[model samples]
Target: MTRRIPIIPTAIVLIAAAIMVRLGFWQLDRLAQKQDMLARFTAAEADRTVHPWPRGGIAPLGYTRLQLECRSAGPAQPEAGRSASGQSGWAQVVQCATPEGAKARIVLGWSSQPAPATWQGGAVTGTFVPKGEDVLVYADPPLAGLQPNARPDPRDIPNNHLAYAVQWFLFAAIAVIIYALALRKRLRG
Candidate 1:
């Protein structure tokens, strides 16, 4: 007669399978959310054209109720850096104006890290993006005028969840295959 296998090991396998499947589903859910956000942003951009003023500034970023356009684009602060490719780099978001102008705003989000600040009266050209909950505009970036508090740092770290989800699913598939072969051998006799 063949010795019996312990139940504890079987239990462990079942638990692992459950955990991996759950993780895969979680990643999928996050993916859906990201897609939805992308859709909304696209629609907003399409619905309206960036309206810039020849000699005017836009309403504060938080005040998305207003839409502004760019008459003259400021010096292209070429964003340079490497974080996650496709979305990486940092540059100033300057809206041409003097020190007393209320429209020297920017369309850049926020960053835990700070970038260089240069407030030299230059030029600005970009569309108006309604600030979202995740968007954070720096109110003060060392420079007062000629430089926007928002710096363009395109190196937005991408989500690694999809990779993680794939790994988890692969683990689960392997577990199923190994356990099935073992169980088949045991029962065949």
Candidate 2:
């Protein structure tokens, strides 16, 4: 059927289509970044052992790789972030066991979202950062919520941006298509 299309609608649709395409690309970029980051972390941990934080005299200013046993389970707590609103994070922990089965415990900060847990005879290679220096003795507790042991697997985190990007791009495309139809109708009219 012949119908009149308006220029405004046509223009809006085209603009929307362009935006959607841009969003889709953004998601792809995010996915790439995440994969790269995962690869880097994996490489760093491979063939490496987790170590205790250096005691004093200038912290390594970096992380130390250490392998913790699975039996070292600890309750995780939220280590507040600088952001005004942030999730109570997992206060990751490590437990060192003596041959006799006795144990020493330490609360480690979140090592990203747990990835596919690497285990060779119940051990995990993780980077150890020194307990952040606390100027106020009581201001922020250095450690909290310790458990026996655990080896959380690395998760293949979803990149929703890709989906969102797709959505935006789809919207943009639809917008453009609508605009084109509108323009066509208006021209005919």
Candidate 3:
């Protein structure tokens, strides 16, 4: 006098829920890793060690002070950014050829206008920032008569793993609840 529970559909639902729960735990692990990385970056920022222009990876050196001579520089291009005082504006960036023959992007300064600045090349000292696959040096002092660009802070990097983990957990719960409701209705009918 009772309908048997569906086998294949129930199996699929449980399996999917298990996967989602596992993913949630994985995100939590990632959150811990991100916290550790941010702590290292904060320490690096506080250290006064100045390194020469890096020809290798920049990830481990982010937020550290670096100095490099720009043997030649391309025309400046203005990118939307914020000034040191937190005012939204333009960032004057230039592609420079380093003495070691490596190319580097330098954020010369900030400006209220989108127009680029006129800078050929010179000795540059600033904070090393790893942006995606590229490396950018944020000038410590305003360059080419432009305003200072906002200093790079590790806090600016987003740590959304906790949010992602919560969303995954919610999805798993929702799936199980929806399946339970459907199964209940089928058995009643």
Candidate 4:
């Protein structure tokens, strides 16, 4: 006697497996895109040459060194920041009036304690970093009492797409194996 595979269940399993595999490939594609973005960031950071801050409307400043002499427009605004050594702490961000009369914010430095007295602003040299809709300067050789926090890395961005892809592929294999085992058991009985 010949045994026939259950058409409905078998079709469902194949469709599910195909979808899982497709999801895995999609994740892999995301991984490649992430890697390319990181590479671009690195390339931008390599050149030490500093450029003047843009006088016109805002621009994309993901990874570039720049020079600016901004005076403190207000007291320091505290925000989260990471140290060069990867320590998490509070960073002082001060509002400043640019030479062209544009309002801008600059991340002064990272510290374990709350921000010190009202920050005394000066001619600052640092890297321009994109933060949400605003761009802030991450001071290099950080201001006198503060530690250096410059050249924020793109590698810091999480790139777990490959691992997620592996998980999807594994899920597809597990589904196939379980279905095969169930089919064999049904055939035996």
Number of the top-ranking candidate, with TM-score as the measure: 3
lDDT value, candidate 4, whole model:
0.78
lDDT against the true structure, each candidate? 0.48, 0.44, 0.90, 0.78
What are the per-residue Cα lDDT tens digits for candidate 1 across 1-189? 665665887788889998999999898888777666556555544443443342243343322222233234354343443222233445344454434443444433222244544444433334434344232223222232323334222223255678878988999989978987897787665
Task: Name model 4 segments beyond 4 Å from true.
Answer: 1-4, 55-58, 67-75, 80-89, 95-105, 120-124, 131-136, 141-145
**Tens-place lDDT digits, model 3, residues 69-89:** 999999999999999999999
Clashes (N, CA, C under 3 Å) per candidate = 14, 33, 0, 0
Query: Evaluated with lDDT, which candidate comes out highest?
Result: 3
- lDDT of each residue in 1-189, candidate 4, tens digit only: 878899999999989999999999999999999889778777778878887776466574567788777855578776777777778876777888876776667777777767552667777777776677776788776764776543477667789999999999999999999999999998988
C-alpha TM-score for every candidate: 0.47, 0.45, 0.92, 0.73
Per-residue lDDT of 158 in model 4: 83
lDDT of 2 by residue, 68-161 (tens): 3435444433342221123333444334442335343344433334422221123434443323452101111122222222222123334466
What ranges in model 3 sit over 4 Å off?
A: 55-60
Is candidate 1 or 3 superior in TM-score?
Answer: 3
For model 2, the stretches where C-alpha displacement exceeds 4 angstroms are: 1-5, 51-149, 179-189
